[model samples]
Target: MELTPEYYDKGEYIETDTGNKVSRKSVIHGSQNIILGGKTIIQTGTVVRGDLRRSGTAHAVVIAIGKYALLASRSVVRPPSKVYKSIFSYYPIKIGDFVHIGEGSIVEAAQIGSYVQIGKNCVIGRFAIIKDCTKILDNTVIAPNCIVPSFSVYGGSPGALIEELPECWSQVMEKNAKIYYSMFTPK
Candidate 1:
């Protein structure tokens, strides 16, 4: 998946006390401004741009990820960009726990709640607020500034609510995330 294999071999990554397995192959800028809660897997080819820091704030974390969040291969998780009062700026991207972003997805969301599963090759637009227990199918393109309600299933070019998520989705998502973390091994 195009990760820096040497880091895994050399064990250079700081394996956090919370069991976060971050691949060295992932392009993560501004490490100090990125917070990974625990048990988060940053897979190969994932690009998390924390260097696009918020304007005028040194302590602002560009990306704050919660526990058990999985960023799959080639996924790009960047802060949402915008032009504010004639100045271009990038806002922080907050991802909640148990959120699974699939391979090749691009997420520039304002917030992603817990137990959300974003399918492969999806494009989550800027300022999109995705709530808990939601599933976005493959190749879906969510529009900017849209709010995705909880317990919903969304898919399409401009993302539409297709159905309601099952009541037990939270448990299922959590279980899957845990399994993925447990099974991950560097080659």
Candidate 2:
């Protein structure tokens, strides 16, 4: 599907040399610990918490977002944390290329594979792994430690696998992400 052009005020965003469009209103904590791959877009009010890291680890990345990924308005990307052997530590979040995290969503997933689309107001639990070419529908709540396979559609509370996607789903999702990024223009 072709996305319509969405314009933003030129003063409201910073366009990096690598084509990353980051909104000025977004709260990105610990910038040094966050890596935004070329052509990524972070929209208004998005919060990326890169400050949370494993104990005793310095100069470690907490969030890594890949190319053409879109973090929509009001979305929150936080590192997943857990207590292991009497130690509490946060883990890194790796978001692959061409992923779209929708508005108002909160993601604490350990990994999100390429060409994935996550819908609005969803809660992706800590350490959940969403594989390539998956679509998570709106308002879903994924349970912690859940493993979502590739080419699947998941929805509902405690997000269950709804159905399998077609073989061409990766291509379709990649195209969609590209279109969305291209259409996001500065006015």
Candidate 3:
């Protein structure tokens, strides 16, 4: 079920078992799909392109974001499509826990790690490996298939290594994941 409200103060999309939610100010165009086993929330002003493939049948985005994973407003997430490929099919995008996705960024065909913060207006290349506790500052490019060494701060034009990641990154992600699991229990 897709929700298109004109304007809402604080909008929430909840699944039977919890999934993706795009806020009221956000524009989601296509078949409404909610994920399960995890929680993913799209904040205000976000635009999710669901039917970009046009493959005769309905095309939906695969994967889910772990609970407490917040996707800031204006972020773009769509089904993975190869720029050039012999066979065209959909690839899924998976986001882990305690993850903070910055505003106005483009992410596709990537497996983001837990406790990862991706800066705004940056591009996460297709098929990238983002390890845990990595802080990718704003305006950086995560190259395709590039292995981001875990527990580091990466910043600069070509993504040069900055320093060791914050000591709290690991602890924070773990806590987020645990709290998320607790939501599944019955009251």
- Output the number of the lDDT-best candidate: 2
Per-residue lDDT of model 1, residues 26-85, tens digit only: 898888889999999887889999888766756678899999998988999999989989
Candidate 2: residue 128 Cα off by (Å)? 0.3
Candidate 2 lDDT over residue span 1-187, tens digit each: 3399999999999999999999999999989999999999999999999999986646998899999999999999999999999999999999999999999999999999999999999999999999999999999999999999999999999899899999998888888888888899988
Residue 143, model 3: lDDT of: 75
Name the Cα RMSD for model 2.
1.1
Cα distance off (Å), candidate 3, residue 58: 8.4
lDDT, each prediction: 0.88, 0.94, 0.65
Task: Provide the TM-score for each candidate, comma-separated.
Answer: 0.90, 0.97, 0.71
| Candidate number that wins on TM-score, 2 or 3 | 2
Count steric clashes of candidate 2.
0
Candidate 2 residue spans exceeding 4 A from truth: none
Q: Which runs in model 3 stand beyond 4 Å of their true positions?
A: 1-8, 11-21, 29-39, 50-61, 83-85, 173-187
| lDDT of candidate 3 at residue 75, scale 0 to 100 | 85
**Per-candidate RMSD, Å:** 3.9, 1.1, 6.8
Candidates ranked by lDDT, best first?
2, 1, 3
Which residue window of length 10 is worst by lDDT in model 1? 1-10
The TM-score obtained by model 1 is: 0.90
Where is model 2 poorest over a 10-residue stretch in terms of lDDT? 53-62
Candidate 3 pairs with clashing backbones? none
